[model samples]
Structures are given as structure tokens and as C-alpha cells.
Target: MDRKKFLKNGLLGLGTIVALPTAMNSCTKDDSIDATNDNATDGSNSSGSGDCTLSPSETAGPFPIKTPADLVRENIVGDRDGVAMLINITVQDQSEDCAPLAGVYVDLWHCDADGNYSEYGGTGMQSTNYTNVHFLRGRQTTDSNGQVSFISIFPGWYNGRAPHIHIEVLKTNGSSIRVTQIAFPKSICDTVYSTSAYKGTANMLNENDNVFSDSLEDNMADSVTGDTTNGYTLTKTIVV
Candidate 1:
């Protein structure tokens, strides 16, 4: 869907970036974890039961297709080619004493390996009929663990921005609550781009990206593990 449709249907609307609170980097034990919870894995410090700092909001970037019939699935890559990646997102509610938020719908979408967005205009792509073909876009519902994971390809870079993934959290009734983007570490991005499929022009660093220039939002960076040859796992908590 286009930007008009997305805003009309409770998805993200075009607006100024929402910087993450600086205190999130130093969140104290008062924002502690719940003893009964066990959703964390792969060395993630974020837990579902803690009163986490609210994640910063971000622009939806003019390419989200948030219609009712777009289809929701765990594997968003389809047949797209690039290094494999696993994105693990944990959604926690800052309002409910930081309880694990279940049944929330998480929308994840990104460009392909060549920096071409699936349903958007790009070089060598059909700009006039971009919406007809949808790829690298999908949604997954958070389980009891407050986690929704997706299998996708490592995203590539384009002009004036860094490599990142857009994520939106919608309530059970389909109303959007939080909109944000996740960034990969520069070192990890370097390693991923070394592969032949991603060896094109490099992306701008986070400080150069307009949306990520705010220092407080640095927490948006993912905890990435693994390599280009064996695939990678990117994990982050979505505190809304």
C-alpha cells in the first residue's frame, strides 16, 4: 500500500523521528527482570518482564504494505538471495509494568540484497507498478514468550542511509502502537557485505544516517552473532 493508505489504516504516518531516551542505556535493576520469565536466549539481556525503556519511534519510510490481506508468515525471504539472517524481536509493554506482551502483531520488512525494496521503486525496477509485487515483507504474532522471529536475508545499503530493518508493533485489534527501525553494528555490516552477493557500495555509518543520527537511539543496534558464511542472528527488544 501507499503512504496514504498506511496512515489511513493505522500504520505509521510520515513524521519526525523519535529519538530513544538516553537513560535506556543505563537502565537500572529497578527495571529488573521477572524471575518466572524465560524468553531470553543467545545472550540477550532484554527480558519480557522488566520495565524497559520505551523504544524510540521512527518513520515507516514509504514502503510498508500494512493491508489486512498481505498475509503473515515467519519466513519473509521467500526466494530472495543473500546471506541468511534470523531476527528475534521481543515486545514488552512499558505501560503494564513491563509485562510480556502476547498476541501483538509484529510487521517486519526490508529491501533485498541489491538494495531494492520489494514493493517500492528502485533502479531497474518497475516504478509505475511497484505495489503489484510483494517480497521481503511479512508479519508474525508474538507468542507467550513475547517473541516473534523471522527468517530473512541480510539487507543491503542504498544512498544516504545505513542498512536497517523496519518494525511495527500493532495491538490485537490492529491498531498501531509503536513504529521503529533496527540497525546492525557497523562491524557486522562490514562482515556481511564482504560476501559476493552484498559486495556493492557500502552504506553510510549510523552517525551519517538522518534517522539514526541521534546518539540516544544507538540502543537500536542489534546484538548480532555468526558470520556471512554461516548466517547471522540479530536480536533486540521492542519496549513500547
Candidate 2:
């Protein structure tokens, strides 16, 4: 395991892409009087076969399905470049109400169109720059039931908070993980949550971004409207 200790344990093995969407409501309903039943469309199937478990601080592994694209941009600098955010991702292992997980492997990344980080956290190119640089690196695997879609654009506003994307959830046991990251498209350029570094990361996320202030990480709340003069389509899902 030596190659600088296997890339420093494969860039600290990224904790399953920062721990799968921090459960805010992976699949739940009853929003008081309702915000249109939270956009009702339950086709859940992250496939763990329902009854969530192993989600408390699960450390997947020293990651090694593939590593060394400049350490995968120094271990995902918010997954640079290909950052122009236009999305429509989906996945489900099971939340009970409706299951639909089929053929998994859904990994994604972000940072660009000016929010920087196309290769090394920001300001793209390296590894000899040119046969050397590859911005916003990407990977998409999931179909039949679990889904994935991407079209790209609108991902600016950086340096502090608001506009985000970072996800990782693998299958084949190891507690059938649900590591997470998802949130972006904050009402055109009103600059999300306004001022003070996006209201201090949306007020320290209720107290802290602790696994994104859970409720089963709410199946990773995802949304990004269209008509940036026409060009946007991003989608995501994973529960297996």
C-alpha cells in the first residue's frame, strides 16, 4: 500500500463523498398544510430493502475503485470544472412508501462557470496542463430504476456558501451506504439566503452542517429550473 501510502489512503477516502445527502427527508410527506406535498413523486428504491440502518458515521473504506487523476483533483475539490450546474439526478434504495433502486453506481461533482475549482479546488489545469488538465471530472452509473441526468450551466457564487454539489453512495454491502451532498440553483442571482456569507451557510445549517442537518438527509433535496435562455437539466438519486 505504499505509493505515498496509496495516495494518503486514497485522499483520505473522501468518506463516501462526504456522507450521502445528510437525510432531511429521503422520503417523507406531510408538510403541514403542504408545499404541494413537497412536489409529490415518490418512486423510491435506493434498494436497501427499507428500514434505514448503518447510517450513523459509516466510514466506507480507503476508496479504490480508481484513483490518481491528480489524486482525483486532490480528492474532489468540490469536483471541479464541468461545474456549470444544470441537473436532474435521482436514486432510491428504499424509504418504504415506494421503492425503485436498480443497477447502482451514481457518483458526481462540481465547481466552475466561475465558482472556480476545475481541477484543484479552483482555477483549473495541472498535471502538466494540456494532455494534463480535465475540468470538473465526471462519472455516471445508474439506470432502469435508479436514475441520473446532467446537462450543465448556472453554478456560480463561491468563496463562502450557497450553490453546492458533492455526492457518494455505493452498493454491494458495507452497510449499503448513503454518503451525501446536494443543493444548488438558489433563485437566479439574488445570491442565495442573502449576505453574510449566505447567512452564515444558512445559519450554520440550523446549528451546523452536521450531515446536512438530517431528516434522513431528505433523499438529497434536488432542484434546478430551466430557461437560462434555454439550457439546464440536472437530476440525481441514490439509496442503495
Candidate 3:
């Protein structure tokens, strides 16, 4: 079977479970957390069982700059300002018996807190010009434990779309094995949007998003606990 077709088909069933490590589970507490400062030992890779499903694949959207070769760092928040956010992603090869996919390249990019994507067209929320601003976009290689994390801000909302982040998983040779978008819990979005830093006021829901609506159960990201006040840590396990 083609790798791309297999991934899409596998996600249609009960295969997209995002397991969190015990260490990164501190968000359950209501106290404030320093997500950026704790980057050394923040997220954990490998879910005990490899039986979990892969994250559902979705469109890369209208703004995607940089290629696999451009990935040089783990921290993609290049001068963007907003509430702190930590994205913890684990990639495993389901085709290879759910083995940890070490050395895999994971690309993550999203819009800024103002609902604008850098280096892309800005039509509705702002001007119709493209800028060299490349915040909230970065790449990281999976470790021996099949884990890669990014330090960013809770994504802002925009028209015709829900609060989400785009991720592309590729092999060491830069061949894309999986492409998908991670959706945020609506409750979290509401809480984050209430803050002053995030001024974008688009109220689109997961059920309304065209791509996510078809696979809401499998596409919706696992529930996260932290808020904008304490910063957020989103953990997900992706089986490719």
C-alpha cells in the first residue's frame, strides 16, 4: 500500500490517540508554569503502546514557506509575542510495527497571535502585502525516543478557520510521510482569546471547519489543561 494512502485510511478508524508523558502532565495543576524555561526536560516521547492511531491529515493551508532543508532549530517562535505555548509531538512508524521514528523531520507552522501568517498574503485582517516575518514556524528532528517539541504561542483565530497548527512529518531523506493539522480544544481557544494579546476575533468551531468536520473524532487534539495565564503545553502522539 502507498504510505500516503495507508496513513489516510488508518486515521479513519480508532488509530489517532495522543498519549502524554507523565513528566509533561504538569499542566493539570492550576499553578503557573514556565514552559519556555523548562525546555530541557519538558515533553516525553513514546507512548507505552504503539497500537494508537495516527493524527488525521489535512491541508497545509495557504501559507507554507521554507522546506525540509531550512529546519535548523527547535524553537520556531522568532520574535513573535503572545502567551507561551509548548507543542509536544511524538512520531512513530505504524507501518514498521509502531516503532519509534527517530531522525524524522517534523515541520510546524502557524499564524501569529493577531491571526496573520508571516511571509504570506494578508487580505482580510490587515494589508494585502507579504512580509519576511517568520514567527511561529520552525522544524525539529525527532530524537531516539520519537519526540520533538516547539516553543510557541497559542495560535490565534482567523476567518473561515479554527485555531489550529499545521504539521508535516518527513523521512530523513525529506520525503513527506504524513501531513496533518492539529486542532485545539474549543474551551482552550475561548479562554486564550479572552486575553488582550490575541486580538483576532474569528469564532469558528471544529465542527464547522471543512477538513476537521469529517474526522472530528480522530482529528480533534487531546484535551489540554493549562491556560494562557500559565502558558500551555499540547502533547500529541502521531503514528505514521
> After TM-score superposition, what is the CA distance of residue 13 in candidate 1 from its true location, in Å?
37
Candidate 2's C-alpha runs over 4 A off are: 1-7, 12-37, 40-74, 78-91, 94-103, 112-114, 117-132, 140-161, 166-181, 184-240
Q: RMSD of each candidate?
A: 12.8, 14.6, 13.1
Instruction: Show the lowest summed lDDT stretch of 10 residues, model 3.
Output: 33-42
Pairs of residues clashing in candidate 1: none
lDDT of 2: 0.37
- lDDT of the candidates, in the order given: 0.65, 0.37, 0.65
Give the TM-score comparing model 1 with the true structure, all chains together: 0.73
Between candidates 2 and 3, the lDDT winner: 3
lDDT of 2 by residue, 1-240 (tens): 122343334334222111112223322232111111111122212222233422222222222223222322223334332212334455654454435565555455544445444434222332222223444444455566566544333444344334445556555332325555554323333332332222222222211233333322333343333333332334444443
lDDT of 1 by residue, 74-150 (tens): 66776667877667788988888767899999998888887777766643542444555677888888988798777
Sorting all predicted structures by lDDT, with the top scorer first, yields 3, 1, 2
List the pairs of residues colliding in candidate 3.
15-53, 16-53
Candidate 3: tens digits of C-alpha lDDT, residues 48-136 = 23246555656777787565466556556676667766677889887677778999888889898887887776565556454666767
